[model samples]
Target chain A: MVSHKPVIFVVEPFGGSIRWHNPSLPLIYWDDYAVTRGDGIFESILIRDGHAANLERHAQRFCTSAAALGLPEPILNSWINATQAAIEEFGEGEGKCTWTYSRGRASTGIPTAWVSIQPISDVVLAQREEGVRVMLSERGWSFPSELPAKTLNYAATMATLRLARERGFDDVIFTDPDDGHVLEGATSTVVTVKGDKLRTPYDDTILPGTTQAALFAHAESQGYRCKQKVIDVDYLLAADSVWLVSSTRVAARVRRLGEDKLKAPDNENEIRSLIDAAMTRG
Target chain B: MVSHKPVIFVVEPFGGSIRWHNPSLPLIYWDDYAVTRGDGIFESILIRDGHAANLERHAQRFCTSAAALGLPEPILNSWINATQAAIEEFGEGEGKCTWTYSRGRASTGIPTAWVSIQPISDVVLAQREEGVRVMLSERGWSFPSELPAKTLNYAATMATLRLARERGFDDVIFTDPDDGHVLEGATSTVVTVKGDKLRTPYDDTILPGTTQAALFAHAESQGYRCKQKVIDVDYLLAADSVWLVSSTRVAARVRRLGEDKLKAPDNENEIRSLIDAAMTRG
Candidate 1:
């Protein structure tokens, strides 16, 4: 009955073999701390033409996230091999491949690792092609010495997105509560473009964006000056254009921030090409 | 091979019958949002003498947490029933019973719910009996209007505990980053005792602790003045005695808060008995 369901590959005991199972089958112990305490780290990468974009970078960030949680260091080669296995099965076209590394059952002390592929939805594609209207929500805190890890504890992120959707927006831009410094999007990194230079928020408070980094690296090589600093909301508001970038959505221009309308990216085609080039580069 | 493993009961769906499965048999989908995004709500209650303590209160808080995440309203009766089933199987003695409800697979829109029972570890019992030495860790944020929800997104909570443990402390009391107000413990609620008054931080910024609430009620009924206020670190430091209260732990006396020694609760026996009576009342 579940033959048609997509299968996820489990990486057995980091640096070990891989096994595939149908999604319908139970795959995680009930007491796995990932589900019990959100005690885990994860990474998602965009796949195009059977290629997993930024796999290396994503894997590095995966390790960084694990370090943040004090989890045992992940065997990067195992993750890469497993992600590739999933992507290979996904074949051509755009899909999102996510790596979930969970602190397994407390008694076991072993970690549960798996990779699953999901097709990018029409809504996401539309947002990528057009733009997204966003609302500003407060993250309610700041980390001056370390960025929040890209952990599986994303309840706030999910809630923020729900809040925006309820208000008739596609996503949200989180602003620091103490000061209205534009932090990042609910699931993506915030980027602003003004004239010749491209800018994004750089601080110990935001998750360092994998897609943003890739895009910036490509853009910088292409002679599009890029800068990262603590960004004020006003600066974003006054920017020539804005975009929310991530592994799957790639780069979705911000059509509206709150009630204020935002201009489309001045170099839309160039920006798309740069992102595509970066994604395809690997 | 897994016959001796503890079993977890899955609620077929809210308002449906339950089925038990061994934890080793894998009870959750790999993509369940509870693991994927930590998008879920859960509750843990102390099971004493075959009774699930203050279950009604736990269920209510469970609903509150679900509401915070904009999840479908839980059918509380099913949770209560499932919890009772697990506790009954545990039978005669103290244990920890946890209820987990995840916003199931996105495609299904059906929430996944389950209950599991665990024997409370001796370390926890010792903490409850001998008191805990705690350190103050900054929560790194302030929520003045709405207390953080007890959601599945507990990466920060787990990380905080890890940090405390690394420093050789049993637990941590989080202080408001903005003003150093005493907040709550990573997995427990903070309470202070001074003279005859029992006080705990009261605000939208802390989880409304179920055990703490029950303790306060029992204490109030006994003519011990109980106050809920926005307590400061100074107040807790000057407190004659302090406690970190939770479901399974009941009320653990704070032997030390940072470097300062705390006097053992003048009414230690009374406090323990009061907590026991409240748990037994249900």
Candidate 2:
């Protein structure tokens, strides 16, 4: 029996329409932007119940990123419909839909785009439950206040994560390249809870973590005195609890930060209860 | 009569064999590193007359970058053989061989690699003659030392170039995110000539430009002093000549740096003569 891979819907280089990915064929030109430059912007949205969660926000952020990268921005509805096409083909029960928009083939230099939907991997799902241990890399460098949040370029980010993993940690945290202060996780935002307040770095150095934003709002609603401010390394080390949150992994409490084992809050389940509700809702 | 496009060769995820890209097929998996995470490092070499210029140097740099990214070292011989395969299949007069060493399919997460050879674009060729106008964008920050040069991720680099082009410049130069000192070009290294000496940045903040290295060596052999040291913005502007050097463009003289339109040297052709010899040899 022939096996059908998950559908990878692609738009023509000029962004006319969407078509299903052919398992028996090559969809992109050999010199497509996806191959040559990785010169594109992408967004990954969680698909729950045949619907893209936080899609409107994701759509806006994607457009912002695309605009920042100066790639042609796809109409917001095109993403929804294309993602729908992927979902219809995948028969989704909790999957992810990723969209890549680029200036088409590197040879022809036209503009094209695509979206792919697949079930979230078990390793990713496992992080939500098991939490994660993270080490800090002094590579505090970050893109300036401008530039897109996420682009196809994950080299430095993934490299940092790989270094952490090799050193027996789950992920690596990038601190401020100058001040030695905390900046962000390889793929998530760092949030800390200390005393009666929850705080995260307020600067634009990192991808404004979508999950973190939702959690911040929820925390405020819970009257936990949330603040978006500079998070120094000393304060982070002294925090009662720290979590790295993103769309996928949802929230992975940092079981350990560097060599020091962080202590979990006595009411850890209560905080998690809030995280689950925030991730799904706001 | 069907017209065949340029060939794009792909390797299996396990890096066993190579095959020609079929127009009627998919070259990459739905979950390939190119598609999902862009979790890969790559190297591009200029090929002329069946020769890959600076092959050994590019290979060594790739290994250094791969190691920095904490990836399995791709056997150096594999790259050479693959380049040969791509060259033979493409029958290259003047093209480039691009090898992407990826952590492989995002699903199974096995290591995958591929190579493609295509004629260098006319835009790149054009830059060699007409020179280029560059605008400074301090936003294009990179990691300090020890990251791969040609990572699949290129958001910030491309974005700054876009911004510069929008403002009616050919390319963008990156500057120190903190001090606003010049760093490097989007895809090239900054080399300036002052008095009897050739100087470029010695620091680890930028990629070691292969073409720049060759040119510097050629300069030294010709009895010119060369130095790799910090290049401040003031020094850059005061230099007699400044050029952006890379593998493909080789060396494009900077006609305009920001608002200042600098005059070209009387012996510009002499410099070009030296660049040509340097590119083909060292």
Candidate 3:
């Protein structure tokens, strides 16, 4: 009933091959932890112009995530092959190439090894240019750093974003519960620029945003000093310019941090190009 | 090919009706949040001697969780009715009545209102009597209390349990990274008794466990002083007697908390009775 239907690719065992999924059919079992308990790990890579950027990094993260969740070693090549197959069929479009390991069904040790390619909507892309309105809300405690993992637990973040939308913000910014330090965005990373310095939170309490890392690496190559450190809310507010970075969002300048207006960096376009360059790097 | 397969029941909205599902067939949509992102809320109630015990409590918790997740208000009656139908089909056997309200597919805003019944195998039930050995591990930071909501993020807890299992422990106990205080278990609650006091972690950092609440109520009725407070690791290790309580496992005494052996509570049978009474209470 909708235009541009999503193309799904599910991974099978050794001899099993991935295929296009029928949208109307049920794809997961009744008891897979991915469904019942959200007991799985996933990755979403941007597929731009038929290329899934940073797939290897994503693959490595997926393996690390699998080990973190105590699952069997992920068949990385199988996933890359399957995702590439889907992307090839989806040729030359902007979409997210996603994969998940849901720990599968509880009954027979069902494995949730699957991948799909879904279009990135125009509305989300608009945030990349128009910039995003952000609000700093108390995120209490986050999913702790001792665990550098993202399980299927998007409920709290979804709820937070929903609340933020209702209150007229594009996205929400999470702060440390104990110290009110800037942690990260629900689906993005926090980066700030002051003079020639580019800084972001290095603590493990947040997802070590790959897109943010790419931008920083590119920035360092360009002679901008880049460092990872804890950023307090006050420090964030007082920064010269702030931006939220991620794979999908790429680099979005924060127009406002709470009630304060953030001055745009003189090198906004230049910084963005660096981030874009890293996003597509192999 | 399986003996004693689980019987599943599903709920539907307008133009939809509740029904039983084949154990071997697919039950979740590929796009449903439950499958794709594990974005949903769920509850599992114990069915003993033909009754879905404490369903009202579970219903209330479900509603609370829905609110916490900022989803639409749940149609609690429909859930109760659906569970009744599943229980009727299963007849007299120990099983869990499970219900989930996944945000559903990202497109169409389709609501995933479903229910299922799965039998509790003998091996799992044995933990209630034989007790469980638990190890303390750092959970870094948890989804903080300001939210008091659980999203589908089960990644860290699953990883911690997996590590503990590899080390031969039945379950893993989480300690706060900052201060090493006891937090809740992956799927259960923590409670202890020392002298005349019944104590459990009162912090909002952990789930407000319903079963644990009932135990406290029953304990208070028996004239024991009940309290909720931060339980440090040392305090838990030194506890007179500790137990991890939940709806399914009921009350499992901590045979060993870390390397310290907790002498059985002089009142093991007494504590069990309290837990049992709460398990079936409406």
lDDT of 2 by residue, A173-268 (tens): 778767877888887889998866889886666777777778888878987888788877788888888888777667788888888888778977
Q: Which pairs of residues collide in candidate 2? A: A13-A111, A25-B25, A25-B26, A26-B25, A26-B26, A140-A175, A140-A177, A153-B153
Per DockQ, what order, best first?
Answer: 3, 1, 2
Q: Is candidate 1 or candidate 3 better by lDDT?
A: 1
Candidate 3: deviation at residue A102, Å?
2.0
Q: In candidate 1, what are the lDDT values of residues B198-219, reduced to their tens digit?
A: 8999756777899888888888
Give the alpha carbon lDDT tens digit for every residue of B218-274 in model 2: 888987788888877788789888888888778889999889887898877877777
Give the higher-DockQ candidate: 2 or 3.
Answer: 3
Regarding TM-score, does 1 or 3 come out ahead?
Answer: 1
| Residue A237 displacement (Å), model 3 | 4.8
Predicted model with the maximum lDDT: 1
RMSD vs true structure, all candidates? 2.9, 3.6, 3.1
- The residue pairs in collision within model 3 are A141-B144, A144-B141, A152-B152, A153-B152, A153-B153
Candidate 2 scores an fnat of: 0.57
Chain B TM-score per candidate, please.
Answer: 0.93, 0.91, 0.93
Ranking by TM-score: 1, 3, 2
- Distance from true location, Cα of B188 in model 1, Å: 0.8
Q: Estimate each model's TM-score.
A: 0.94, 0.89, 0.90
Docking class of 2: medium
Off by over 4 Å in 2: A1-7, A11-16, A22-28, A194-196, A219-224, A237-240, B1-5, B11-16, B23-26, B177-181, B194-196
Query: Between 1 and 2, whose lDDT is larger?
Result: 1
